[model samples]
Target: MSDLVWTRGVEWLAAAASDPRACKRDWDRGEGIALLEAGRFWDVLSVPDQLGLLTLDLLWRPTLPVPGPTLVDTAAHRVGFFLPPDPDSKWIGAGLRHAGEGSWVAVPPPYRSTRFLEWLIPPDGTGELHSPTTLELALRQANGSLSVLAPLCGG
Candidate 1:
């Protein structure tokens, strides 16, 4: 991906961190590596009904033509919204697929959308999320509420 695109995504992530309504959730740091190794892009999604954070795994070929350098051909992206293991609850998995070109349609919950937002920063405030550049790029890709352009432009 181009540096600018990556930077934008990082800014968005930082801005999302500032969102009061955005819930703080924990995710595996290794998941990012795993997704890249598996040729997929994974994102974190926090749903109101769920108690903890959820992961949306986009299982795509990454070989098709995309608009930007960061864009990749999406063979099939799946959203696996799961609730972390708890004393009273087991891991639940839901599958969402891409429908109608750029839309990701959940099979179980029945939600449809071309784009969904996921938290790039973990709740712990450690790992890759700490980098200002990383945060900017994530937020740019998210087109999130942070309005991170100012920081990204060195404002």
Candidate 2:
């Protein structure tokens, strides 16, 4: 049952790839990650891992929002959260990057967790994604908190 869910989830993510067949082929060949185009299925909000994790903590507090797919790239020291695409969307934060129209993001298969690039929150094959507004709020709060503490930590 779990295998089927993961398989479906991978299929759901592969649709974002420029070439779904090639993406599947790379996964079959045991490649660690594949680059998938954004804007077709979803957009990505990327930030430094520390701030991203803090934002996640804030997002989970009080009550959980509908969970969305998230990626962590330890090698790049970045974390990416998937959100429904909005062509004109602009995100503002100290370390935030918006990958919306005409952007590509490296993604590991939903069932795979590579050492560097892996899923922090895997898709459930339901095509659900994070709310951009909610994510922005959490990111804003986290960024503010981190910035306020940076000097204290001498960072």
> All candidates' TM-scores?
0.20, 0.91
- The TM-score of candidate 1 is 0.20
Write the residue-wise lDDT of candidate 2 on 61-123 in tens digits.
658665588889999999899999999887876778999989989888898876698887898
Model 1 misplaced regions, further than 4 Å: 19-58, 62-91, 94-155
- Cα lDDT tens digits for candidate 1, 1-155: 35554444433323333231221121112121111110012232222221111111111126421111111112233222221112322223232221222223221101111233232221221112112233223323433322355478674
Instruction: Give all candidates' CA lDDT scores.
Output: 0.24, 0.86
**How far does residue 19 in candidate 2 sit from its true spot (Å)?**
2.8
Question: Which stretches in model 2 have alpha-carbon errors above 4 Å?
Answer: none
Q: How close is candidate 2 to the true structure, as a TM-score?
A: 0.91
Instruction: List the lowest-lDDT window of 10 residues for candidate 2.
Output: 58-67
lDDT of 2: 0.86
